[model samples]
Target: MEAAIKFEAHEEVVSFDQEGNVVVNKESHMSKKLMARRAIEAHRERKRLESELEDYYFEEM
Candidate 1:
């Protein structure tokens, strides 16, 4: 079977499998600056959660 998929002009078509799965290209969608910002935000959130957990653990001791 053949299928046609339409996307925006800025969108990149990575690949389509026989199982009807559409794979998007990450590199084309995410810029280095955006990726760095996301990484930093994730790291900060992780650190905050870890600190909270540590504080709770110490308080319970």
Candidate 2:
């Protein structure tokens, strides 16, 4: 089974200069860390739920 929703990490604080170069912002660093932490928690929750479901099925059988 797969997650119903998939998260794709993208750069949102990028701006082009006169030379048309990608300039990343430093503020996005914190947000990226937060996003990574959230993703890990979500993964853990999914695994926990899956394990519980399997145990329930085994008990039913």
Number of clashing pairs, model 1? 0
Candidate 2 weakest lDDT stretch, 10 residues: 1-10
**Which number leads on lDDT?**
2
Candidate 1 stretches greater than 4 Å from native: 1-28
Q: What is the C-alpha lDDT of each candidate?
A: 0.59, 0.59
Could you list the CA RMSD of all candidates, in the order they appear?
11.3, 15.5
Runs of candidate 2 with Cα error greater than 4 angstroms are: 1-30
Itemize residue pairs with steric clashes in candidate 1: none
TM-score, candidate number 1: 0.53
lDDT of 2 by residue, 1-61 (tens): 2342222245444454676444445556447676556556655666699799999999999
What is candidate 1's local distance difference test score? Answer: 0.59
Per-residue lDDT of 49 in model 1: 90
- For all predicted structures, in order, the TM-scores are 0.53, 0.51
TM-score of candidate 2 against the unseen true structure = 0.51
